[model samples]
Target: AALRELAAKAPDAIARLKGIGLSGQMHGATLLDEAGAVLRPCLLWNDTRSHDQAARLDELPAFRALSGNIVFPGFTAPKVLWVAEHEPEIFARTAKVLLPKDYLSYWLTGRMVSDMSDSAGTAWLDVGKRAWSPELLQHSGMRDDQMPELLEGTGLVGPLRGDLAAELGLPDGVQVVAGGGDNAASACGAPAISPACRARCILSAPISCTALNG
Candidate 1:
């Protein structure tokens, strides 16, 4: 309906769209069932119910080795572990997991994918390698099949699907790029990534600071 309204107001809007770059809550988790339906309400980045699980995960040297960061209740990995322990049925039904922005991308492009930047906060990624960590997955009680394919932030994951494109009045081949998480997206175009940048980041208050390279 909103699409129709947008199309009514500017029929060329979608056609004019060159690409979609998304930035969203870094740790929110969306679990998808085998049929591609959402298994449950997403456990958002701010949800703190997973603290106990996160504390337990912090004990694993393997986890610290892979992720190079401390586990937090706000991270996706422990939240998933929380779900697995408290809601086994949902975990059993999950076929793929996505971060918040990836969930929107899945709806738009029908692809299950995530960018390295967004994936980093999941504590399921090998941050140094910028890829998923199988050891972390196993420790989290997740299988390889339950993770989305990882992509670089600027890599093209797919083009708009035919039906969705038609419905949205978008051109057939509008490219969809893998987007970073909220902080990473903000960090991408800054003029510099010096100690000054990091300093200002601390002053920014409440913003998640991540590593940035030129």
Candidate 2:
């Protein structure tokens, strides 16, 4: 509805647009079945039902070292473990896992892909390598096939679906960029370019603190 409203308000601008960039809350797990149907309600970043799982994962030094972040209950990996334990059926049927923004990107572009900053919070990425960690995925009982293809936030994610473009009254082939997580995107909006500079977003619930690196 919000997108439609925006499109309606500025048809000319929409037509003139070259590409669409997405930014959404990080860590939320959006699982999809083989047919691309949502398997369950997305477990959001603030959800803490996976505390036990997080604690267990945190005890494993490799998780913290590889992810370069604490194994928080709100992160996607713990949530996946929680789902596997509490909702095995859904876990068994899950063919793909995506962060919130990537899920939206899939809807728009028909491609299963994710970006670095968002995937970083999943506790399944090698932070330094900027890629998925096979060991971490093994620990989480997730397979590489279930993960989305990764790209940098600036990478191209092909074009929007033809039907969606027509429905929104926009030109066909509006490219979708592999955008970042909310905090990372917010950091890009400010003039925080060095390690000494920090960007904070208090407006968002569960406010984010981002460290800008040169």
Candidate 3:
């Protein structure tokens, strides 16, 4: 609805657009059933209902070693685990899983692709290699088939769906670019990633901070 409203406001700009970039909250678990139906409401980045699951995953050395981050309740992996434990029927029916923005990409392009920056927060990607980790997926009771194809933020995710493009007043050839998570996208926009930078703040649904070092 918001997207439709935005597009309605600028039909000229929408028609001129060559590509659309997506950026949304990181670590959100958007589960999909075998038929591509949403299983339930997305577990957002700030949801902390998976604290116990996060703690259990955090204790596993492989998680920290491979993902290069502590397993937080706010991450997608633990949230999925929480769903598996609490909503067994939904977990059993889940055929695909995606972060919020990536899910949008799938809806737009009919392709399941995700950017490294967003995948990193899911605790399922091997941060060093910038790819999905089989071991981590196994640990989380997920499979590679359920994950989206990996892509760099700059990579193209193909053209928008023909129907959607028509509805949104966008051209048929307008491609969708794989984009980073909210905070990572913000960092890209801000000039705070320099080595000398000590700290940076982000104000959003949940305020956050980033620290840097030379």
| Candidates' RMSD to native | 3.9, 3.9, 3.6
In model 2, the runs with Cα more than 4 Å from the true position are 194-214
**Candidate 2 local lDDT, residue 31:** 94
lDDT per residue for candidate 3 within 1-214, as digits (tens), equals 7767877898787667888899998999999988888999999988999999999999999999999999999999999999999999999999999999999999999999999999999999999988899999988799999999999999999999999988866788989999989888876666445544424443433234554343
Model 1: lowest-lDDT 10 consecutive positions? 202-211
User: Best candidate per TM-score, number?
Assistant: 2
Estimated TM-score for each candidate: 0.86, 0.90, 0.89
| Candidate 3 stretches greater than 4 Å from native | 2-8, 193-214
Question: lDDT of model 2 at residue 144?
Answer: 91
Candidate 2 vs candidate 3: the TM-score winner is 2
Q: Name the lDDT value of residue 43 in candidate 2.
A: 99
Residue pairs in steric clash, candidate 1? Answer: none
- Location of the lowest summed lDDT over 10 successive residues in candidate 2: 198-207
107-213 per-residue lDDT for model 2 (tens digits) = 99999999998999899999888889999998878999999999999999999999998887778889999999987886667534444453332233324444435
Q: Per model, state how many residue pairs clash.
A: 0, 0, 0
Worst 10 residues of 3 by lDDT: 198-207
